[model samples]
Target: MKRLLIACETIRNEVELALKNRAVEIETIWMANTLHDSPDRLRDALQAEINKSEAAYDEILFAYGNCGNGLLGLKSEKAILVIPKYGDCIEILLSETDNLERIRTTTYFLTQGWLNGEKTLDIEYEYNLKKYGERRAKMIMNIMFKHYKNLMLIDTGAFNVEAALPRVKDIGELIGLDVVISQGSISPLEKLVSGQWDEKFCVIPPGHPTDYDDFLGISLSKP
Candidate 1:
């Protein structure tokens, strides 16, 4: 059966890395990375994509998380919708199940997709500099990032990790946050694309509308 993978640009690198060297037939459609900044925009954009590709594939897989209640009202009548139930792309980047609980409290996660996405930590800082003077930008970001003390980068094995260090170091120094690097896996995205719809996934059938409950529940079983 043919399947379409509708993914957030924020985790595009991980999804691409997951399909590497594997005989997977699913086609990918990368949604704009900036959509996550506004969930309503993300929902409108996703529904539009679903409408555009519904006839071409048997199923559509969404490689996204709850994303700040963005996926709450999205639904499709043309094809079955498959998506992960995590909170956001951060959870998808930090895809290791065991490591999530351990690191959730202390760190903010980043990935190649995130590094390149809109409103990325460094990009926001730069935007602040461009809009406001250097002194004002630093002060603005200091208040914006006051809660976190750690910047954790999850290496999903797709891009050059070392090449990203200078940017990471800059963020750490700017926010007084310690930089930590960790290993990541493609298993989550791989499974979602491969039809291995385990507990982590929500399989919504055609003609049914998805609401906030889909992402909030413990188990989103197929009917």
Candidate 2:
């Protein structure tokens, strides 16, 4: 059966890596990660894409999380829709159940995709700098990042480390946060792409409309 993987460009590396490793014969549609800036717009865009595939695919998988609740109400009529049942990609990166909460608390996670995605804090920093001047921009940035104590880079082994490491480190420096590099596993993405929809995923069968409640539950996979 033909499948379509719809996802933000942010996880392109990890998703592609998983697909390549699994050798899944699914076609991918890359969407701009900037859509998150406006949740309603993102929902509309994703729904439009999903509607387009109602006749083309037997199964359609979303390579995304709840995001800022942007993907709250998406549904499909002809194909089963599947997605990770988590708040954001941070959970997908740190897909381990045992240490999930331990590692994610007060942490602002980073990935190669996040670094390149639009409408991010870093992007806003530059915008604030130009629009509000150094003083006001610094205050705004501080307000934005005050809750985050660590800037973690999820080393998913999906891309070249030599290049990505420095970028995360530099971002940490610019943001004045402690930089941490952790070994992340693509096992989650690998499992998702290969149809191992365990407790960690939300499986919305065909003909069912998705709801916000679909994002709730114990979705951590067992070790």
Candidate 3:
């Protein structure tokens, strides 16, 4: 079946890595990372892409998670919509692990894709520093990241983790948080692109809007 993968640019490296050696040939469309800042806008952008591409492909795969309910209302009029059953890319990267909930509460996840994004934590820090100077910038950053105790970098094996360490360290220090490195697996994305849509995926038939219950299997209030 012809398939098109629409994904967040923040996870481009992982998605590309997953595509390697796959038997399936799925076309890709990378969405802007900045849209992640607003779920409503993200939803609109993804729906627009789906509307434009649904007729050309038999299946449309979303390499994204619920992402603050960004995928809540997405639907395809022609192609089936497939999405990973995840809350965010961080969960997808660490899908093999058991302590995801604990990690989510105290850790700020990082990856090469996130670091390379247009509006990364470091980029935000620099912008603040330029506008408010060092002292105030540090204060602002501290307040923003007060809930996070560690900056956990996922080594997805798709990029050179060692090459990203210095920047991760700098960001950790800037935020007064410890730096941590964790192994990550691309198997979930691999399964996604290879059409292994098992229990780990939310497969929405054509004409069905993606529901919040599809991801969690529990009815939660829509955002």
Q: What is each predicted model's overall lDDT from 0 to 1?
A: 0.78, 0.80, 0.89
For candidate 2, report its TM-score. 0.88
| Candidate 3 lDDT by residue in tens digits, 85-126 | 888888889988887887778999899999998888889999
Clashing pairs in 1: none
Per-prediction backbone clash count: 0, 1, 0
Candidate 3, residue 158: CA error in Å? 0.6
Residue-level lDDT tens digits of model 2 in 85-152: 87777777777645767656667787888877766657777898999998998898778778778888
Ranking by TM-score, best first?
3, 1, 2
Best by TM-score: 3
- What is the Cα-based lDDT of residue 99 in candidate 1? 52
TM-score between candidate 3 and the true structure: 0.95
Q: lDDT by residue for model 1 over 1-223, one digit each (tens)?
A: 6788888777777777677636676778888887877877988999889888888877898888877777766777778888887777667766665757556676777777777866877778888899998999999988877877789888878888999988988888987789999887777788886678888887888888776566765323322
TM-scores of all predicted structures: 0.89, 0.88, 0.95
Ten contiguous residues with the weakest lDDT in model 2? 214-223
